[model samples]
Target: MKTRKEKTGFRIPDLSRAAGPISSIVAIAVGLMIGFIILLISNPARALEGFAWIIGGGINSAKDLGNVLYYATPIIMTGLSVAFAFRTSLFNIGASGQFIVGALGAVLVGVKCTFLGSFQWVVGLLAAMVFGAVWALIPGLLKAYNNVNEVISCIMTNYIGMYLVNWIVKSTVYHQLTNRSLPVANEANIPKLGLDKLFPGSSINGGFIIAVLICIFAYILLNKTTFGFELKACGYNRFASRYAGISEKRSIIMAMVISGAMAGIGGGLLYLAGSGKYINVEDVLAPEGFTGISVALLGMSHPIGTLFAGLFIAYITVGGSYMQLAGFVPEIIDIITATVIYFAAFALIMRNLLQRFRLRKGGERT
Candidate 1:
């Protein structure tokens, strides 16, 4: 019989290594700890109250949670875009450019294609996806054939898309009084599916539902299909896959196109949410494009995980907004989120170490 000392390892084993949601959960918890520390530093007397406010959600209305869903809709799409490209080993940093072009397409359809009545919004969304795909295709092709760095090309396209969309809006749908694109026709609006009644004072609509379904669809496409397998194979090792007869260049282009489409769909869903979002001649990149990258990282680059990641990010954002009532600046929310991202990276490292330990222990046992 094994002695008591032999029953277990001399040192305690760290459980963080096992594959599961443990890492993500620990990352979030530690992130909150950091945020709490910040809160205490900023306002010692009101720190407890402010911290509660950050996590209390809404004290007065269901609309608070509803608004979180509203904000999450587009991010979920953008997150999926980033995650899909990441899985294919293509860093599509041009999601911003794709998102802008897609928004332009949706706006055009919203303003001119209202004649289609109830079918107008659907057509507008499809147009947006096509526009985004086309925009990303330039960088994809350049990377595939000319060996151009996609990151640089994507950055260039971001400016191009920004200026192009600005010009398009100015020349066509310019609303001079508002200094933005004109209001979309009601016919092009996404239906609320009675969510408005369920959560009053919120912009919640069917777009969130659509985003969820699309997330599932992307998961199936990436994990359960032969094409997905080939794409991943190309990503894992282009030379090996080429020897196996895979068209590496084609895979690269297709992966980017799909990524851009997802981002474009996000733009459409956001602007068509019946919330009166309009394109302005802002001198800034679409923030959602970058936010999606963070969401993808937080979700560990999995499409299904991205869905929940998007939702959680949105939830925290909403909670963060409430911090203002407790005398905190809105920017404090940004700090908290950044800290969360930082700790999440640390948690990933710990998880990797844990996995290595498990493998080594198995080897010793054998």
Candidate 2:
């Protein structure tokens, strides 16, 4: 028995399947540790209490939990948008442009199409998706036909969209008194579906439910469909996929379009939540789109993972808001969020290294 055990030698555990989740967890923990250290440095006396608030503030009440879900809806949608594009090997940094364009379209419909009665919101949502897709199409066309880099085109579009939207809002939907777009008609607001009674006083609504359903749909689309296979194949090897009869150009375009549609839906959901949020005439890009990039990275570009990641970020955000009572400034919250996202960027690299190590050990064992 001793001879047999000695002969067998040691074997490495298979961790290929678990690499993504494990790397993400490690990154998140490291980020939180850094945040705690920063808190200690900023306010040594109240560090522990502030950190506690950062971790547990979301559970303070039913209202806080509800607000978490409400805040999560748009990020979840944008995260899915980025995650889907990542799967197709497309970097869609134009989500900000797509989001703002979609918002404008939705608001246009919501304000001017109250004649549709209860159906106004549905039409507004669809308009938003269409607008976003059209905005994204420019980069897709450039990338597929002219060999232009999507990143460059996306950056250009973001500024163009920002300025263009500023003009459009002021010309068509501007309210001089508020310097923001006019409020949407009541009929165009998303239905709460009894969430009002459940979460009372919170902005949570059907948009959260819709975000959940879309996450499930995205998972199924990416994991269980022939089309998804083609898109992924193109991503893995564009030339090989083209040789195998998969249309790489078409896949790229479709991926960008779908990604844009998801972002567009996020814009619509945020505005239609009846939370009194309106588009202000500013030259700034939407922060939700950039936040989506972080969510996608933290989730390792997986649909369900993106959903959970979005929720976690939103939870941390709500908790961070409570830290002010413990003597931490609002800027401290931004620092912590930036730190977490910065660490999240390392997750993919860690996963790849883990897989490489596993493969090397497996070869040795064989």
lDDT against the true structure, each candidate: 0.86, 0.87
Put down candidate 1 lDDT per residue, 1-366, tens digits, no spaces: 112334665544445335336677777887778888888898988888778877776434699988989999999989899899999988888888899889889989999887899998999899899999999999999999998988899999989999999999999999998899988899888889999998899999998999999899888988999889888888887888899999999999999999999999999999888897999988889999999998888887888788988988888788888877888886776777787777767754676677688879988999
lDDT of candidate 1 at residue 182, scale 0 to 100: 89
Compute each candidate's TM-score over C-alphas: 0.92, 0.91
RMSD to true structure for each model, in Å:
6.0, 5.8
Runs in model 2 deviating more than 4 A are: 1-16, 348-366
Top candidate on TM-score is 1
Q: Candidate 1: minimum summed lDDT over ten consecutive residues — where?
A: 1-10
lDDT of 2: 0.87
Quote the positional error of residue 340 for candidate 1 in Å: 1.5
Candidate 1 residue pairs in backbone clash: none
lDDT of 2 by residue, 1-366 (tens): 223334688444545358767877777787778889989999899999999998899888888889999999999989999999998888988898888888988999999998999999999989988988888899988888888998999999989988998899999989999899999999889899999788888899999999999999988998999999988888777898999999999988888888998999899999888999899998899999998998897787899999988998898889888998998886776676677677767765776688688789879999
